[model samples]
Target: MNNDHDSSLPEGLDLRALSAFVDGELPPVERAAIEAQLAQQPQAAARVAAWRAQKTALQVLCGASLRNERQAHNESSGGVGQRDVDEPAFIVVRRPTPWWQRVGLAACWLAAGAGLALALGPLAPRLTGGAWNGLGGQPPSFAERADIAYAVYTPERRHPVEVAASEEEHLINWLSKRLNRPLSVPSLQEYGYSLVGGRLLPGEAGPAAQFMYENTSGARLTLYITGISRDETAFRLFRDGNRRTFYWINDRMGYALSGPIAEGKLRAIAIEVCSALGGKPESWQ
Candidate 1:
């Protein structure tokens, strides 16, 4: 696989190679080659950055569990004792587990305890309570996820979405079935943003959909949709770094419009989207 020169290029680097590079599993020579290619490919570099960010997030979420496990292992086996160098003591150096391996274990632990913390909504305050108050009082998790999805996909020069706008009907139908809800693709052309495409995603409850749109200036926006148990919310704005999302729940469904544009412009676009989808646009005021 390392001998394939074509695979080293941005266009040819497959997901497996990219995963290996993110995991730091590549040899120095192959790693250097991929790095050179990534430097020339902003989209590919963005993907790598996203993966790294995901790993970091997982580590933080599962840090306490990991520490407990490490402590347990240390107790099960006799703890290592310090030795003085002047005594000429023989010290056994045990290599630590790789971060990826530890993170994998933490992921399993998290999966086993998933039900404790579900999607953020009205019930979220009761479930997570003061734990998430620092994030501006139970900020919707789906909207934050939408912001992340937009950041991850909008930088692509090619293959930004799983399906293209040319296959709009098929894309909508497929996503609708997967999400178990009739979905509509809002026409953003009037706002100078045309539909680019969309893809299915894993949501806090079940499947979610993300429809992407791009304007003439190459600026992109995405509308993320998912099912919710209840319908009670006013338009709310969530800011994550440079990205902002205007989101709300209506008719037992949640929608988040995410972009890097100015707050006023994105809110206008989001209000239009809400109105098109039979939502109460007046609530946005």
Candidate 2:
């Protein structure tokens, strides 16, 4: 009865279920079900790869920051042999907490302060730029990042991506492992472009993914992705040097396409990718 490895998984494993599989929280039956989905749904596998990359990136960023701070302290204090009165009690500052957070207090007090804090949070942070300025943490610059990545990978001849599209199953499984997002590499054959290949890219968010397709004349386009990030708040067209970028983001993930194609043709390409992606343009804005 099983047609593919993915067919042996639960049923059609949606993004959420795939995420659970990556996180090691899925039970065996459920895990098997997701494996089933992966066998048939390439896009779902790609999403899983993007999500896995995000998890690794998050840990790396956090771990590096911690390690750097400790190293700095050791260097300044002569390997912790000396201490100064002016030195703060803690060697390194932890991630900031916004002013409205009253977690240390009683649960009763937390309820009352939560609403007022969130309401007034932005204004106070902007005004002071102290706790709020560096507080609540900062997100990586997704827009500029997306652009840079688009510019870097679209021009390769020999090694543009890690897993080439010819091995569609391998590409899906590898990316799914790397991204932690269940991905489906939307078929672009109807757009006159067949799959050329896909690559894993490093990004501020994590290992970003790019899938390349080529047309008859060797013209190529790419689909860039990561687990959902806030920068995908709007649908916009971006131009970098001579290349064109058409990008959009949805609830579960984000996508950007870059290439040296005509705008009219590129728009059609983007529309097809978006439709295959199963995203709503309205939510992006």
Candidate 3:
């Protein structure tokens, strides 16, 4: 029985555990195994010792900075525990200070890549949201995002989206929870289109919601959505090839329906959806 992972190792430690061990972040059982392995292999043990020293050095350096800061305030005449008289200073919050500081695309890519690298770690937090950086300093329009999703996903033979419509109840409930809004997949079955499925996509506004439909002839369509800002009010459409993407934002939420069903057929389907959606008050109001 080979319990070993595929990587260079000391006696019995694996790469992942080795990494955790190096960081002093491993669980006790893992730490024990890594230590046992270290003792058995002189070269590996030396490497692990060097990593431990580096980790210790970093902690000490940061600790020294904090100590120096505390010492600079020569106002404390009381004992060590007397510091409780004052509240701890708040750490500076680092919100993205606007991306267009884009000095260069390469630098932008590096920073974005650094963000993505954090996503690979086991301790990585779940991704919550993002904002698009448009060219020339304008914010990227959600409509443009809809158009892109339309072009890339509508022509697909497989994997058009996630959370296919087979799980209708689950899809609706799950997406509704994520968007913090109730969602209805308007029925277009009366107009030759039927529910095909849907996908859960990530978005800047929230969990991007997507639903798909298909007509009897196999033509496909999709609805994409996420909450948006007030400035995004209004309905719009974009086209490329046989595909069309129609998107709109209201006070409550936003939606985009895209597909390759010919214009006339597509319009009819849209009308059905909109009617089921309580008619387009903004466009025809």
Candidate 4:
């Protein structure tokens, strides 16, 4: 409708562009083309419908919270407070958020809402496409992203780590400062894996660390660590596609040990890692 066709777009537009169209980021011509496609494509139509439903849910939740805060502010001032005369009763005036903050807010709603799986199912694959693709909204959680990082960097012939294992002390210090937490490299020597190196990665919450270890057979594993939202001790074994990972949250930090090793072996390594991090197997159980 807007143009004859989008030559750059494939027969079907990508998930990222479709998501942008939903968020009103696409040009009017592109928007019209996507709308036309959605009308003919049932699956694409469903995806757009789901995203709209999620957006409406977030607006409702955000509005309700703002209203509650306004009421509380009024009560605190004895029901007499200065207000924006021109602002509508339903609108709340506050500091403006950047574009990324708006995307992050959508992420918050997805996390807290009951439609998490429904919302994420359609967007998970696009997240692994690259770092820049998922800025329109929350792609997947940190765990899955960490798995993608592993897949991307583990096969390198060289430059596997930004800081080599020989610089262990500096590596520990640097990562701890970036993460704002005391970090210790676990000894995997007993399990036939020696530390090759560690590197810094971008995480959902903030900066993250990835420590790599390799055994005599050239098999490698990584310990991924980052800050979590809350302080809690929880452990679970998760398989993202083919990558087997044992992820846990300890105190304020979250860690995941990932590899293609056997379940028992990975579990053993995870336990040793937990013990080194001042936790026990039963505690995680």
- Runs in model 3 deviating more than 4 A are 1-140, 231-233, 282-285
lDDT of each: 0.83, 0.70, 0.66, 0.79
TM-score of 3: 0.47
**Candidate 1, superposed: residue stretches over 4 Å from native:** 1-136
Q: Model 4 reaches what TM-score against the true structure?
A: 0.52
Candidate 3 global lDDT: 0.66
| Best-matching candidate per lDDT | 1
Q: Kindly report which residue stretches of model 2 are placed more than 4 angstroms away from their true locations once superposed.
A: 1-143, 231-233, 282-285
Q: Is candidate 2 or candidate 4 better by lDDT?
A: 4
Q: What overall lDDT, based on C-alpha atoms, would model 1 receive against the true structure?
A: 0.83
Residue 279 lDDT (model 2)? 73
Model 4 C-alpha lDDT per residue in residues 119-217, reported as the tens digit of each score: 665576576564332323342366676677788888986888899999999999999999989999999999999999899998878999999999999
Worst 10 residues of 1 by lDDT: 81-90
Clashes of 4: 0
Sort order, TM-score high to low:
1, 4, 2, 3
lDDT of 2 at 213: 80
**TM-score (C-alpha) between model 2 and the true structure:** 0.47
- Give the per-residue lDDT digits (tens) of candidate 3, residues 1-285: 565453555446566666677866888987887777777788777767887787667656545445545665544745352343354534445687465575577688999987776555333333322221122223235556666776677677677656777889998998889888788899877777788777777776667777877777877777777877653444455666766766566655666778776776666666566656654644633
